[model samples]
Target: MGTMAELFAGLLEGVSEAVAESTSLQGNHLLELAVPDDAWRQVLCVTYRLERRADVPANSFRLSAQASTPLPFLVQVMTEDQQLINQVDFNGGPPAAAISGSLTSYNGQILHIRMSLDGNPLVFHLDLGQPASAALSGRLLAFTLASRPLPATPENEQWPRSVTRQAFVLGYEDPVTGQITPPCRTMPPALSSSRVRQAFLDLTNLGIRSPKVFPLLSVPTDGAAAQAFRDALGNVDTDAVVAEMHQGRQLTATRTGSGAYTFRFVPDARYTGPRLLLVETYQLTSVPLSYGPGRVIKTFTLLPGERTTMRVSSYRRSSQSIQSTSSVLDSTSDESEREFEQAVTAEQGNSAESSKSFEYNAQASASAKGSWGWGSASASVSGGISGSNSSARQEFAKNLTSAVGKNAARASARREVTVDTSMDMKLEEGEESAVERTIENINTSRTLNFLFRQMNQEYAAVLHLVDVRVAFFSGHSESREEVPLAELDSLLDRVLNVPRTAEVRRQILDLVGATRDLTGNTHPGFVRTQAPDGTELAPAVDPTYTSDYTTPDGRTITLPGIVTAAERHVMRTDGVTVDAFLGEGQGLDAYSTGLQEQALRAQAADNLLKEREADRLQIALEIARDGDQKRAEAFRTLFMPTQIVNQIDHAAVNTAPVNGKPSS
Candidate 1:
């Protein structure tokens, strides 16, 4: 199932479109509030898709929203009075003009929205057809290592003097690669329930390993064009691929059996050559039909073994559904749906996780880097945050920006053009002017902030960095050592994260081209910590605690096995929005940093309180060690608990070698 965030995005967009078509509001208003820049706990938005057959001059579209109930968050479309008015007054001069609008709420009601866009902003024409609603569906299979047959115990033993504890390690294996993936284990729900145990049994019995439930597609290695895509598949810009795939009204994912999916609606077939994008979605809202308030996409990787592992379960229970919406089962009436749900308690404790999705759907949502355990980094950063040291972050941002700007400008100022010397100098100067104009469009701050946030999470983009360590002025001491990242300490982690795991593994084995050499040496690129030119950074750091996932039999496993994929829909809800990237989220980054600063301040305050406590205890100990004879004698004059307790034989608190009694 999609993390709660994707669910809300897809559902809200669907609802908004349905409402737009259903609403009485008019005009060519094709405004969709699906922009990632705008967000909410649970919100609905109206969007527009324009279509005009011929060139025209001046066209308009307006869409309005009205709801009977008070909507919590209505982006773009509403005013102070909750009055929504989205209007396209007129596109002037040019035959066609661009349009942008905000959003309002939506509901079950579906509408027929008429859209028109004058290719030249001249004459407007309407396009018809119901925009399809996109949904996410998938199956969740949770598993654990099969228990080694317990050392045989006496068959008749009933005393239970020796109890064999079952060590519960939570995660699943990949269907295609047999690699085990461990899910993030933070605030897990109650586990003592029969249902969860049932799930465990169901998954354990499946016997298949590896979550690459989707069957592998063969990439054409013969054709020149095909070969190029195949070669680049090992390392490509995640955002570019996602952008290309989502460049339409919808992207469809069909289950091709064995819990695998094949995607459609890709603008370029070459992109689908070696890499596969998969997303898993589940409902977040309890409301029977509402998509949800938000979704959660903790981590995803171009490589499958990044954040989540997949296991194929051919054991589809006749009517059984376990925390998923992607199962093939007939839906019973609302009264009968309850039959599938029941609470599971740990064998001992009452604490447990809620059984949410028994079925789910997954598709591609590219994550820049595979999961690089950031808990230690977050902790270490807390130290750097002390004393309001914002200068470091600011300096880094400035330096990075300066470097990028210089490079862009330098590339643009290539005076050595292979030009006909006879050609006018105006042509070259005009090109320079265009380059200058392009600079105005680049929002460095927006791009920088996004990069900073991504850097804070994982640094796999520059996979050459086998070690990540950096020195910071921590309050504890200058140059104090810190353990930050331990799991992502090798190339194995990077290789697994690359798409087309099976093919990549085969290539590495054969040592073909850039693959591992006959000596089993990894790709040449695998032997570096810093980029050749040193633009990329791979900090050398360690983990806070010992992180070992080796099996009992000495089989070592690599990290980031678990990945979070989301359904790539008509509208994106699970990514950094266009508006945000274009400077809208500029100050938001600073705000986030401020929040981090505040958190550090809290930590500092906590440290201060602890120091005071220690000092206070030390002073008390010194006073006692010296002499309080006079004070003790005076206190004894009063009827104290020590004296009173002695008389009643219920004494307490007088055992500290006082009053000449043998210290009891």
Candidate 2:
């Protein structure tokens, strides 16, 4: 298979042939399933009848099979084959329980999946041009691969260990240096357009337009440092949208009596992968002075083998401010319009990451002046709700920087990244702008916009992948055992049907290798991403949200999106920040030249209208004096042009002076 899409298609064929036996492609709903836990057969079979959701066309995009019930949520697979089979003892003594596998390639490679562990199968990849930081193998243990074979005991005495040893390391542990290196977990494998569409529906709790389904690319933003913004500045047209979806119940308290209620979350049909469910409830017992609306927050991860999570939340807030007289209380008031938001956020295996918030305002003030004393105290609180550093290769950034000749004025880059970067977190710490108001909660697209300046730092990015075939009997190992074709067929089918992140790491690294530069603002830049024909990419379109929640609040309480309210906020663009920064028909068009043109056109029309009004008044005066239309018309023509000979530019006709002065 030349591409990831082709690779998955080839795998789906194998799975279809093995499961259905006959390669009849009619009414196929092809899919590579990561088998759910507690499956009966390492090799099992069942007969399934087919049904069509829609009438087929002459040519249609179809899957290999469609089950009556949707795929269930996947739990960790438990089997007896996960143990270490062979040994590679680095010290020539005992095989370390965990080994640090290296690529033996050059240092600072892009997307280096440096190490892996047995339990956490996801490969942890390092960013390009990262520092030469190695892990230390501190301690040694009798690893299953390196240690001598254990003597066979009675079945009841000890359980059998799994035997699947893949040479990989999360990182090297340096005991002497006392350094504990860490790596990012492998990303999810490539997904199909259909799969992504289905996942989008499940994650955002929204539907898509018909006949406009584009292939949704599975992008990785892990370890990428991005300052979250909610404004339209960075909104990409025809781009993927990442939103964190919440599924739970809403409960409220009564005026009195027991005020408690609970809601259970249901798994979505489209998202059959791992899931995380967070349950929460906000409580506000009364208004201020007697305000019982309280707030609480907690985070939760999905537990293995668990389908549901249960949580209980209870809160109350009461406060009062009063102006006091010498012996009695006076001028007391209650706080009004108090609101609280209780959010339950669960990011499922990176399906999506999103946030939601509520506007909360609490204010209290009291003042008193008497012979006893004068005192004043007031408090006001406004509730704002919210919401990877992908690094550049050291070599790429340093080398490209020097390429800009000394004659060229070097521009400083604040932060530069590809628009396709799906989701990211900021790696730097700072206040974005001292003059501009900082957003507190940035969940909306409007509020998430980052103010940035174009810099001279330029970069080029590319994505590429390569695959090589190896003979299993000889290449996989030195011939520990031989297998039958039937078993071999099943294994091949299983590999294709499952999502393996190792493959993803390889592809991402390949992309990094192909790219000359990805992100940075060190050197001066005038580069723009272009097509093969050298046409610059089109301007980004306005982004759409999963849903607009601020409409209900209206102008009285302006509630902005929370996606941008990220603690770390700001934008660093590849262009300048001035009015003339962008060229014709580019960004800032609506607010810049667009506004100037309208104002100028209006002024020119107003001047013409005044001239026309003067001509009409002059014609009326001439007609009234001469008592003839033709006479009035001739008088008007005398002032046809500005340079007329003997021109006396009089606005209206007049009679001879009655005494000393002429009168109209």
Which candidate number would show the highest lDDT if scored against the true structure?
1
Model 1, residue 29: distance off in Å is: 43
Residues 508-575, candidate 2: write the lDDT tens digits: 22322222212222111111234459786521111221111111112111111111110111112222
Candidate 1 achieves a global lDDT of 0.23
Model 2 lDDT-worst window of ten = 356-365
Q: How much is 453 displaced in model 1, in angstroms?
A: 60
Candidate 2, residue 275: the lDDT equals 12
What is the C-alpha local distance difference test score of each model? Answer: 0.23, 0.21
In candidate 1 the C-alpha lDDT for residue 165 amounts to 22
User: What TM-score against the true fold does each predicted structure earn?
Assistant: 0.14, 0.14
Candidate 2 off by > 4 Å: 1-140, 145-664
Root mean square deviation (Cα) for candidate 1: 38.2
lDDT (tens digit, per residue) of candidate 1 on 527-588: 23354488654422222211222322232323221111111111111122111123344434
